[model samples]
Target: MGYINIDFTAGCTNNKWENLLHTHSIIQLVNTPTRITSTSSTIIDHVYTNHPENIVETVVPKIAFSDRYAKCITRKINQKDMPCLCHKQIRYRCFKNFDENNFLGDLNKTSFTQIEQIIDVQSATAMWYQLFLSVINNHAPIKMKRIKHVRQPDWLTDEVKEAQKKEKCLPKQRELE
Candidate 1:
């Protein structure tokens, strides 16, 4: 992709830059004017791609920073080529049957004398860690499960979804008020 700041609509004059891009088999995708003002509109920002066939759609979103709009391109993707499309295996501890009183009783019954007897600080820490880990594992065992991964657009986050829900409810809220 190539973006150059040149007026592409200058009275139908032969554009050397465009001609150069054509020579290299590159095609300009954006036809709409990128920069617009009250007096005039011009295609100052350009988007060029060599593999135009792979591009599914080209959009010039109406989000203005200055006078220029943001350019977006959607490309065709193969599902088999994406590893993220497959179900992923993950291990997690299940705490559904965990009892706080039972866990506490087991912890209290556990002997820490072996750990205390160890003169080395590292070995004592390791033994202490292992003792706690064993008790925790017995109470809440680790299980593996496969989960399907779903992909969402980068701009559509949890916060954005919440905001959208609130926006949808505004009309009803106003009517009640």
Candidate 2:
């Protein structure tokens, strides 16, 4: 939601606005002050959502583009509704505990006679693939893992978050000066 310029935290204006929103089943998500000065801090900016339970998190990042901090909300995605947002399940062979010597010994002991005896080229190729797969499976078995995809910006880090906390105080510091 955009700036209503009415402080929703105090007075009759706040009560009327809150009553109207509540009647319509809309809830204000932001609780922190959106704008701050050395003398005062007020919540002028707002975000209203009907499905409050769907909201996972809300943030007010103090960006320098405006006096008011940016309001953002992350909603929980339903896998059936948003297939693209669902976590991916992948199958892979993990080689973390694979022993090279054991693998080599197994490889050396394996018989290639069945593949050699096969007359058809396709059959021989299939047999060779199966034998190779068996050796690989014995050495490093296939594993299944679920990977959750996050949408955070690549540049966002612990250092950047700490810097933003420091940056938020700069405006008030300037006003005081």
Candidate with the greatest TM-score versus the true structure: 1
The residue ranges of model 2 lying beyond 4 angstroms of the native Cα positions read 10-13, 83-177
lDDT of 1 at 47: 75
Q: Where is model 2 poorest over a 10-residue stretch in terms of lDDT?
A: 168-177
Candidate 2 residues 72-168, lDDT tens each?
8899988778657568886656999899999999998889887888887856765686687789899999898888864556787989879767745
How well does each candidate superpose onto the true structure, as a TM-score? 0.46, 0.44
The 10 consecutive residues of candidate 1 with the worst lDDT sum are 168-177
* Per-model tally of clashing residue pairs: 0, 0
Cα RMSD of all models vs. native, in order, equals 18.9, 21.6
**Count of clashing pairs, candidate 1:** 0
Candidate 1 has what TM-score? 0.46
Candidate 2 local lDDT, residue 42: 80
